[model samples]
Target: MKGQSRRRVLQAGAFAAVSGAAAGMTGGRATAAASATRPTSIPSARKSGGALPFLEGAFTPATKELTAFDLDVTGKIPRDLDGRYLRTGPNALGLEDPRAHHWMLGDGMVHGVRLRAGRAEWYRNRWVRSSQVAEKLRETYPGSAPADDFACNTHIIGYKGRILALQEGGPLPYELDGNLSTLRPYDFRSTLKSSFTAHTKYDPAADELHAVTYYPTWDHVRHLVMDHTGRLARTHRIPVADAPMMHDFALTGKYVVIVDVPLTFDEQAAQAGALVPYEWNHHHPMRLGVMPRTGGTVRWFAIDPVYFSHTLNAYDDGNRIVVEYTSMPAPFYAAGLGSGGPTATGAPTLDRWTIDLTRSHVTATRLDDLPQEFPRINEHLTTRRHRYGYTASAAEMWRAYETVDGQIPDTKFTNCLVKHDMLRSTRQVRRFPAGAGASEPVFVPRRGARDEDDGYVLSYVNDPDRGATDLVILAAQDFTGHALARVHLPGRVPLGFHGSWVHDA
Candidate 1:
């Protein structure tokens, strides 16, 4: 059984490494009167667009129907690293790369899961065998063709008994040690980016290891502080304006917290870049910034006028600084210009937000709307927090029409899984009425289930007009009432950008 669950997660990390409470639960300390006050100054024109006040309806549906499970393991979802900005479609039925491959794509194997006695262990991110990306994609695209779904982009963090692995396509910062698979090369002067697309953060109390990158030809946010054997101790720069970037960032101790989203290179080249010259007329503004974990000075906070497609989780809820986004409502600038103008024919309402960085602003919430003529927002759905609190997944926009025989909304779209409970703030929208395909969810946590509010949530729903794909499971405390089973899968597996669940002991 996987060598007795990797020796019971190395004997429960040698009994929690002598009980420092799992290294203070992955280390992070806050308090200097909560980072020396000074929060409250947000409104760089709250992005204008007044008239939108209507709160009251925090989700309520659970009539009763909970029971889910179907961990069918088949496997096939990982391919994309050719970069000319990577593009491929027509086969695998029309693959489309969703936000950040594995969301940071690799660094301690994208820290996903690791339980043990209850069981689960999955790791992927191959191509180190004297690398050369499939012989340079067959000697420079001699008729392009390579997309059998490979996988990597960060992962491998076991601690105490050791297991590092965070090799970002080699430039610096590499370590693979699942108990000694020994793939050396760990330098760490930071600013490293050959492809593991930065988004890492570890600070077992200053043992340090942070990351950030996003230059877009100098919009600024280079920051990289390392240690814990990776070396490089500091590097700075955090000036943000037409590039509020950083969709995900957090580090409690010295306080990092970056949850930005002010991007508009003509709306990132109208939904997927291609006009260059740094988006001529520029207009990327989504805000929430804070810095100081040793690189002083930076404090931005603006909200309203959102249009984020994914990733936005910043925390430190010890008196506010929550942040969690997945917003929608802006795209009609020729629908982000995928060619065809008139804001590319409008429609995309889906809303969500919850910022409060100590009162700097933000509190718009209104999930349940994506029929605005398919404006697209299933950018791989992801927003996390657990122990029984927040959870998210919402990508519904089907519209398949060849002359329509049934499925139709924009031609077959699916993505639904929304669990929330910000201390009873409400929310639980699950789905499977026979349609779903956007994948990016994995929240096990049931072992010793005496009702720790029960738990289970794995996903990867597909049907792309019936090529087929499934691996569903839900019921994290009755997610909107029941779906608990589905394991189909024999072909078609493209819909990946993030996955993690390595627990089996």
Candidate 2:
């Protein structure tokens, strides 16, 4: 059979099997399934036999929805700062089998901190209400029903007056209010026919949002663009051999960088009940394609097989396209999402790939040897040469767990936030407290700022000792100095994926 027909058959078989299983289950079993899907107040304490690394420490989910006003602040918040810092991540409420729970398979929970005129207005954390969540809470489903009812976790951003909670691999974006309340599943006013991605690049020059999205059930991915008015303006279908997990992509002045890594969908793994059924395939060729932003034939360049979760930035430099990102060795090699210690290829590092248009070749280089991930740069520099980039230390984040065989010791911890000066070939690090962990650093440029680094870096630092998280603001130009301000939150904010600084309009 052809690949498309084979995929359709497989999907049908899986659906039938699930339907049969549900039909055959007793009332108790049905109750159990419902219970498993509900969000718990807090994660249970770690078991004596060893627990999942993500379930403990800073990765634990907040117990309940919280709303706090007049947040305590240390130092002074910039008077010019005005907007909300919103983030979302997997926060598992209840797990039937904690041992089998993957870090990326949890319910979606969004955390937000509102800032205005030098004051921390409020901090709120709310779960994005999927159908299951709404059913469990005995409430009506919010907004338009999604094509799929999976949690829209991973990243959150504000675009065209809409705050969207996004996820990868086949879920629609959930819309939230300015106060972080789940409004409904948004689909560009019914313009989107396929799934949306967790990451979307905004081109200020064109006033549009671009994304490369993928779904496991499809044999191809799509390049989607939304106009400045929040309308789905374009969709380009790109064919591929297999269903690759394109978690994130990059956008430059001329092209949208589509990375096809070694990680592909595993039908066997899915049938075997793996929560995240994608794994590394040694046989799969790793490559990247650069497609013209305005839509044209894609230029493909083969690269070494590797994995990366996020891209810092990409831009055009003469005839060469420069892309900087965090490179990892493998995915789910040991178990779960980035569980187990570092692989033989070493920890995740800041790497660069220069695609030469003239030579039709790609040159890979290591920009920084430091183990780091969750890279961010000034949004104003998107699709342009940028001087500074920021990343959270991955030294402790990824190496926190021992191998499944228990060969290495579990020394789970969090480290510093880093500022890299690409032009100067130097970096300044700001280490957090001993037991504290920080989320991805978001760079918010000052209003009417002249230089690229003239902004404030914002992060949610989880302080285990205090059982709370703080939104830390650092002067971008003064990287190693004391924080400009720390807005102490009332509850814990788990280490999450990505977020954006939504400026007030």
Candidate 3:
């Protein structure tokens, strides 16, 4: 049955490849655009945050699901690579009215590509059967075994043996099978009772997952710890000044850092019928609370107002803690504000915050002026300082990929990947062609790797020119030159959030 499913996916791809009408049907351009002029400005939605243009263009959800087997390999796939690369993003199953949309409110879908023994095994995309997706499919919201608030659209990972599909402000996770099939809601076997993060840090040394979870509807942020066995080991409340939508948090050797930014759930925005109710509240105090891993008192330090979707890494520096992330100069927009534009300039600079434990203050520094986001690092050196960080190049650097309907796309997009060297303050980048867009670069340490960065960095690139996707592998030692391998997919995979490389062993 799995083989049949894979064959079906490949057949669909072959049809799309050979059919001349597929360009119009799938929104693939007959020829690459001569130029792309995506606007940088957005509007403020007074009411009914309608029709985020970002969602329509490059972010459009597919009309059908697919499963393709034995994808073609363009280069030699290292035999050492043995795993599934799974990425999650909003893939709307149905949007009755495009005007009533937020980029974050779309239905959830996951795309997976497996590789083993130097073979591009298979490719599959599955929509998480959330209430919204279930309704679109005319199916019930599955069994009532373990209820959850699961968008399941942001990130996916393998925890112990369970593949957890995650979202922010959602307490429970939906577990998926090795083939990207949804199982059911998993709340640590119903031991958890609070919202969790899409970004959970797994400590390589401790062999535990640590998360500073926050519920948008609640006031307190909680620190959660799960053992290597995938059991909920501990949970404690981390005091916070406000209940901001904590998309991602920071991890250090001894602490879990919680950021309280200006993006808050707005009652007025909700009453105004905005699909995404969070807004930038300039008056709200921007602070960082450092809580011990053992769950003690939280030390709060006020900092300049800022917003960021991801952090590269954090580490302890004597009495001071250095946290590195990508932050912009203004209050970042939560969603496209009714097409007028986002809340601030979307450009992101590599920002560093040094939190002084003894002085009770934070020294803010702008390490790099480049526009970058989705900063990632070698996960093995997550808590401790490593030399390199990786990020998706901001959309402004690339021509926007057209959507199926060719409607919208003037928002955040990625076309290149970057690697930052912390010690020398240097950066190396790999820029995809004009019509190619890249996702977040996830670093996987090579088997029996010795150095912190002795590994490979992997990501998916959607090349509009080819109307397909590629799983590109880059040698960590070489930074970014040419891809070590490019496993070509038969169909397009939309831009997505976080993903994980699940080892088969």
Candidate 4:
């Protein structure tokens, strides 16, 4: 089964199950009616006396979408660089319950900086107008209606001459122009019938985009492949016991790595009023599935229970598959996204999992002990052996804070960017100033680059002292050396998820 037929069957089954679950959870009342009275964010049970951590400081939501011209630059901007650094994140208009707000729930706002000929051309931000946001703005909804009215606020990428703001689970992607203006909800020309994933690995060999997508209402996940022409080429549904939250996946030359961790959607929690209703389940079996890219039954391997939100890269090495990611040893967001900090149990670390095909065994190893997240690598080496990997320091951003005198004083913390020399078993770190934080480091290969690290690492660093943000560029080969350039912006670009350097075509 493929295309619309397969989608209809899956949607029918999912709707039935969702209806039954909602009825059971809400005593047969209409789901919409039940949801009307409940909080729009998370439950109030975990509400604190002060503002939520995600809504304060650098994570604060931007009030209006603005465009600035001719950004200030501290150092020489690379002449070869000509593109836009675009990122999307949750920026709420207004919360129904501020104390119960989850960090992950909000309207999507995209921030972008355009670079051309050694000059910072412009910096602009625009909200991806969902139905709710459109109504609030008194404008008609753009494009098609999205699934469940959820905003695409996780990652933004340029695919086939189109800028797409993406998020996992259920919702379709919101297409945007180069200026970061929302065009419409894009569904690959109406071919993507189920859902779209935020993280899609581009297979340079096949000239395709590979993704593992899951919907909260479905009990299975789909491995989707889009051909070089940006049309759906293949779809394979893989079943699981519970509806797991498969945020990201790994891609190798031969296999698509499926991480079926214990984090699952909870209907009860959703009915009881949790905006982001996924919770970690200890009873759920933690396993990994290796499925052939060509299509076949998945080979499942049981593993220790651990959650990883992002994967650096994976490759087929002889008879084994090597995977590296930022691993969270304990369950996270059990209550809600903003209920607790990510470092409650411990800071996440860069870890590796080696799966042996012949022995049908898996081994886990810690590559670096330092806390890190949002691992990235050179796109040219994706799905192949790579010498260098980059990550942002995760030590300070999500640290827990205590309320004092009905206020949670902002805690000053510093972060850094790391470069790992995988083959040499060494690493280099570049620490930021106190009260400063950096987003994910995006590697952009230099024009006509030769070596693997012959490129630049770009990140949006927020400086609390200046109350502004800067697009910091560093020579990837230099590792910890001085920055190549710092494009200063007028305001803070909130800490966001994955982004990419969309080169001019």
Candidate 5:
């Protein structure tokens, strides 16, 4: 049965690559140390004891709190009575207030849902008719719209008591007014098309609010300052030469940092031994660019990025600006063989870098040596004041690349989280149990709570043997190895792409 299942998966993967679904489909693992790889199968329900074994001497808060819920949304395709298609799942919603009660916005896809603090009751109805946006998109993209409800790709942000949302494909700002039940939707699509990523930032010196734009395809960043009334105040067009085709960015008080991942079709084609068309090779770049928030000229530099930085993804921590990355070089196999050939070979590297803005210098460091066991870092998990926290993933994972000679294939990979100290250049590392998936850990810090240790670290561990993903909530302060709570997810939360924290009331 195992052998038969492995063959079926390999066939599906080959078909998927030909259909161009390779990029969107994630979370595939090697079936066995010797067998080939396949898309991970979701497991049935199971329970966990809530103990994370590796968080030793990491966080020592006064209390361990489950202030907010780490909701997971896995996409399920279902057919309607008329045999139409539909998608259902939870998305990453941005919180608008200090209170954990309301969620200001919803992503409306597998991981796109969000809400305003204290507004849990708002999602009871679909006030913003997704049908309307669907019509607009159908007219624009033609043939791309599928019948049934589609994802809006919305984002919620908070600034000076005001809440706003940037829908997925456009740059229109809607006045949320802390109400999702009767949301006052305005037609602001004329301002911009295809809003890849959005954030509400404040300029203290000017006492102004800024709504930023992330262009994922073309690799550009734009800023539009708006008054309290939601009126556009000023527009700044910032051009980037080496921004990642992936469109990830960060913002500080005085500067905006743009990062570009260097995954290009040309490189893939070169490795695949085929000639890829020019249209597919446009956005690839291998560099990072720094620009002043006020917008004059931009300065670009090259860096081999391994993973993305946590919240603010890029930030200035007093002395230096640190951009954390997971380092994995393009293996010779991928470059030599392409999609139809053998798998990539070699170990991966996960490390962080401190870029000195003042002197235009950079320093790289490894995160494997900290005192704590697990360090959590991603686009969403960052210290409130950008202090010390954990960094995960960005490390390397290896798998069986190919079968050679008359000998069996030998494969090895490492999955560990690090507790990194930004100020002192130190980190602690912890390895997960055997046969667990390499997923980032979610750290929820306690705010305004009596017991400082009352925070919980939420993570999903995919047990390949059992074919299930377990949700483990551990005491944040008990990084020295303690268990607080554990539960089983109803289904697998397809390895998350990113996460964030919404503090409590």
Candidate 6:
């Protein structure tokens, strides 16, 4: 923000060499050939003021793919628990300046652990092969390759029969094996053309995967619909007007909710070699567009300024659509990344935004003042009226961040997991010990779960001081109680973006 090219932090001195080698490469190529590429680290390409906070400490990248068998468990694992827990983060490959680095601009690495019959089987980590990565991997590059490359970092999910790692505004998705190895290209059977978002929703009734995606070349954001069998169903271009970075969206029983925040892609910034191409442009004007699930007329509603990527849940509550999220004064750009940003908005506070369908107006009310984020709920309750909501403490979310200046400011990473009872407006919190941090809570329904809260909340707990990471599983109904099980891993896992559970049949 200090100079005309604030984003040059990504290009200029830091990325000049790396980007030069990467050349025209961007996003990533998720092909079978990429799987053969090896991961190499750059001796240089580090930040001056102590490698951006994310590339250090808990956010440090792990080199080897250590395989641990029969992990030590602190508590009894539920007999019904069966699946692999996988998460992804921007674990940068090598050779770049840390000074111009943005936390979200690194290559993708996925950390995964498997469980079966109440036993912890194994743990593994793999990096998604982006176009920038092949040069680091392929000692001898492939002669020809696909043009659509991807970062495949931000998020991962198990859809239909595939375990796909995804990133917003990139190639389709990267397919990973059950062991978290063998990364390959995925495009819903060659159905996708350009891009997809990090967050995609499923409609059990219709067995359809839905997402509103944005690409640099597209003038409008388009909705992607895939059938239950993982086949592309339809693609409809929505006229949101300008190209805004739309991270996550919500689904009502009949309508899809899209939030057009201030973050937008800048061609000039990108051409300048800024790794993180998007910048906040208030001129874009923030708005929520409500359109039918099948794609038709959109009822647009204007709202106050807030940049929240993840929404807990949204449903058709009578004639009003109630959407819940951790709304902040501004996006994380204010917290760190650079200076002269809107003053730190404080923690992202949980709030409920009610959209009146008939009147086309939005009414918002604060649900809780305690900053919390990554709101999740049981999949069965999505798009329908229900009660339970889960999240991590907002303080712990950005604990490793630093302002443009070289100062270790006090930051709060969600050190606790919380459950929000929407109907009653009450909350239950399960806090970790001092100096410990938690990951986003992924809700897993019990074998015969009857009630909305009848499930287990799963998250990774990292204790850097002790040098260890544990997958902590908590009974949803009794959140504050001891974890049902804490599957401990061999080493510390860098703080990451997101993950999901792939339940075994």
Taken over the whole model, the C-alpha lDDT of each candidate is 0.34, 0.72, 0.67, 0.72, 0.35, 0.68
lDDT of 5 by residue, 1-505 (tens): 1333222211111110000000011122212121111212221111122211111011000010011123332321111101101111112122122121101112232211122221211111122224333342242332332222223323344445433333421334443343232143333324333342333444444566554454323445566665554455567776654322232355555566655445322323223333211112223545556667676676666655443322323456775666654433342232122222223333333456676767777677765432111233332323223434654431212232222221223434344454555557655555665445434455554444344334555454444444444444455556546444333232333322233333211
Instruction: Give each model a TM-score.
Output: 0.26, 0.88, 0.85, 0.87, 0.52, 0.87
**How many angstroms is residue 81 displaced in model 2 relative to the true structure, after the best TM-score fit?**
1.0
- Model 4 Cα shift for residue 156 (angstroms): 0.5
Record all residue pairs in model 4 with backbone atoms less than 3 Å apart, i.e. clashing.
none
**Candidate 4, poorest ten consecutive residues by summed lDDT:** 16-25
Top candidate, metric TM-score: 2
Give the poorly placed runs of model 6, Cα more than 4 Å off.
1-47, 138-144, 331-344, 394-396, 401-404, 408-414
In model 5, which runs have C-alpha deviations exceeding 4 angstroms?
Answer: 1-192, 198-235, 241-244, 260-285, 302-313, 317-320, 330-349, 369-385, 393-417, 423-430, 447-454, 463-467, 501-505
Across 301-399, the per-residue lDDT of candidate 1 in tens digits comes to 676554444333444555454444344444323112221101212223334445455766767666444322111111111122422332333232212
Candidate 3 stretches with Cα past 4 Å from truth are: 1-52, 145-148, 340-343, 394-414
In model 1, the runs with Cα more than 4 Å from the true position are 1-131, 134-137, 141-254, 257-291, 296-312, 315-415, 419-424, 433-437, 441-461, 468-495, 499-505
lDDT by residue (1-505, candidate 6, tens digit) is 3343432322211110000000011111111122333544533323353435455555556554456777778888888888988888766677355555554656677878788999888777777765566566554323433455655667789988789887666456878778776456777888887777788888777788898887665688988899866888888888765567777888888889988877776767666765555666777788898888898887778888776657788889778999887666665452245521122345566888899987878998999876567788998777888798988762434443323353545644446788999878899988776546677789999999889889899888775444677788999988999789988777666667778888874
> Local error of candidate 4 at 3, Å?
25
**Against the hidden true structure, what lDDT does model 6 obtain?**
0.68
Cα deviation at 280, candidate 1, in Å, is 49
The residue ranges of model 2 lying beyond 4 angstroms of the native Cα positions read 1-48, 331-345, 394-396, 401-403, 407-414
Model 1 CA lDDT for position 70 = 24
- Per-residue lDDT over 80-166 for candidate 4, one digit per residue giving the tens place of the 0 to 100 score: 999999877776775656665455565787878999999998887677877877776667775567544456777888888888888
**How many clashes show up per model?**
51, 1, 6, 0, 60, 18
